[model samples]
Target: MTVTFSLPPALEARTPAEPRDGVRLMVSRGTSVSHHRFTELPHLLDPGDLLVVNNSGTLPAALQTLDGVLVHVSTSQPDGSWLVELRDTDIARTGLRLRVPEGSLTLLRPFTSRLWVAAADVPGDRVSYLTRHGRAIRYSYTDRDWPIETYQNVYATVPGSAEMPSAGRPLTGAVLAALAGQGVLVAPITLHTGVASAEVDEPPYPEWFRIPPSTAGLISHVRASGGRVIAVGTTVVRALETGTGEGWTDLVISPDHPIRVVDGLLTGLHEPRASHLMMLTAVAGEDALRESYTEALREHYLWHEFGDVHLLLR
Candidate 1:
């Protein structure tokens, strides 16, 4: 289906001055919408409700050289190889070598357009190798070496993701305590998010994810007990959906593959034609998503990683 929604220049104000839960939260279920502080999340759900989170830790996927050009690496091949994409360069050499603190980086010419397949020789597993040789793959817009801690989810673990599962960012220590105090159940699953496709660009890359049987069992137990399964972000949705084998989901989310596991989804506003919007279409239907997105735009909701959050329930 062709998609359309409102885009407002004013919405940029919603960019989290602080990239945590600075996002405005909108909760929707049964034709109702309630705007509330993200901290108030626990109050909106019942005790024993299951909150499934993606524990895929973010990597310092961005690296720089003395020349000032930047590189963004996303997913890795299961065979311990990397499928990388490059940004901010017109130098299309057949092979490019990037110098890092501990090793030399090499790129195999354009996989497509501006993307290049790159890899580095390090001392251990890919994650460990990256830890020693790379910086968290960051966007030029950010312009800083945000410590690895800044890119990790509170409960993140495992190591294949290029970035944090951002929708869960608001569930801080205090919020976790609040959820615990309220008897809400929090379970973590791993789904490493590859490099985020730009709002204005749609790029293709391989999928990198790992979902444990125990996590699957936990989700099943929650649903079997009549507790709602709340997915924290699109990454979590992708992880849960991909792991469940509803079908081979190699691309974006869509209604053709309606979600079979998650009872609700908490995500951020996306831009026109953004691939993640396909996931929202799967969760809320193209019509409802357009309606909610229209409301978000008109309400001046922010966009991007540090923006407003959307909560939709089935």
Candidate 2:
């Protein structure tokens, strides 16, 4: 089925900061659209609604020129060396010139004008490296450090993501409290986002992921109890759907793929043609997804990680 989608200009990050949970939630069911706040998620669903959250923690994956040049490493090998995607090209490759304080450098390699590889010894764990050398990945619209914690949901645990599962970002301690107050059940699963790829093409590379059995059982229970399984982000939907067979995914979801689970989705507004939109199509179907997105564009819901949300209920 063909789905038409677009974003509203008003939703653009014309303003840098949006209050946590202050973004709008555009709820779509059939041809209808109901504007709501992200904080109102609990009240919008039934008591038995099962909320599935992605606990994949985010890394301050964007690096800058401290000594030389800044390259954002999206994926890392188990060996600690990383294949980072770089942005600037003014620096020489002979010596990695980054703005990072002295004694922070380890190894460096340039892959292309726009990408490179850099390594650091780092103290403690990988998280330390991120804290010391990296900043959160930002696109042209956003221009600030959103705090590693702001990029995360209250329930995030597993840490390996280059980006946050933003749809879940709207769910703060207050939102969770409200959900609990309303008797909604919340469960978590992990799916480390590798990198945010360009919408112009397919995914750039394979993303590694893992899901625990306890979360799987919670999903099964949610399904069996007639509680609508609501995925907090496209990452959660992808993790649950892809990992159900073996708790992992090397597969990409698209309209052609058949979905095995997830009845509802709470996700951010995506850029036009983003691979994520394809996954959303798989969940909401062509016609409805198209209508909802088209409406979002007309209504001016924001886009990107810090943007507003789109909740599609089937």
Candidate 3:
């Protein structure tokens, strides 16, 4: 699958969309498409439809080294080592120690081409340490730094994701109330997302996810009752389609590996050649996805975490 358009820098959403209650939403069902405000999302769904959203919180995972290089903390390994990305450089040497604000990190070895295993320490818990010294991760598309609060969703509670589960960013309390009033079921699953390799467009690594039996039961009931199980982000899709209650997931959804659980998706616009486009293809079909992207680009829809969203229903 090839995406033929280039993303203009001006189309990048440099800041959070104002007033989270509404934003541009492109709804695609088959090869058909329509534009609507995100607040109209409830109207687009049937009474029994279920919207599965990821409640994993964003961590202020971007930290600066003593020399001012940025580090993206990806995950805490079970053995007390941390998996991190040295964002300022393309290569890392093992046994190199870099001094951080609170402490220092000693690179143990390579975890991936862009990530390394390291030992990290601070005054207290990792979260607390980050709260004091870290900032939200951003790329060149953003013009300036924004508060960490802007990187969070209204309902986020679990603190783990290196970046925000941004598809849920525009959902507000008002929207949730409206969905409930319209009899649309909303369920939460916790999926701790690791740092994204946006530069490389690499396949995602395993991340922790938890779908309680209650949400699992809701999925089963919705499917049996002729309702669509709509995932709010690729994170939720990965968690639900893995068909597990709680664990780390390395599942990669593509056209060849059919998606069994999700019937629809609400997600941000993915970049051309992103691994995420493969997952979107699984739910929306290749032609529909291609059409949607072409329309989005033509319509000047914003891209990235703070951008507008796309809804794909099967």
CA lDDT, every prediction? 0.70, 0.73, 0.89
Query: Taking the tens digit of each residue's C-alpha lDDT, what string does model 1 give over 1-314?
Result: 45676566666533233646555888766446668778788888888788888787887777665456666666766455566665655664757776655655578656656666666664566677667656865543453556777767778767778776778877788888888899888887776677764634563345655566777787888888889888898877776776653222365567787688888898877777777777777777766776677677666777766677889887
* 148: Cα error in model 2, Å: 3.0
Estimate the TM-score for candidate 1: 0.86
**Per-residue accuracy of model 2 over 1-314 as CA lDDT, tens digit each:** 35644454556663433567888889988667789988888899888788888887888887765555666667665666666654655544645634454334443775444445557544655566777767777666666556677677667887888888878877878889999889898888777776664424445355566666777788788789888889898877777777653333667788788888888899988777677778888887777887787777777778877788889887
In model 1, pairs of residues that clash are 60-135, 60-136, 60-137, 61-136, 61-137, 62-136, 62-137, 253-278
lDDT of 3 by residue, 84-128 (tens): 899766557899888998789889998888889998866766677
Best candidate, lDDT-wise? 3
Error of 2 at 101 (Å): 5.5
TM-scores across all candidates?
Answer: 0.86, 0.84, 0.97
Ranking the candidates on lDDT from highest down gives: 3, 2, 1
Off by over 4 Å in 1: 13-22, 123-125, 140-145, 244-251
lDDT of 3: 0.89
Decoy 3 TM-score against native: 0.97
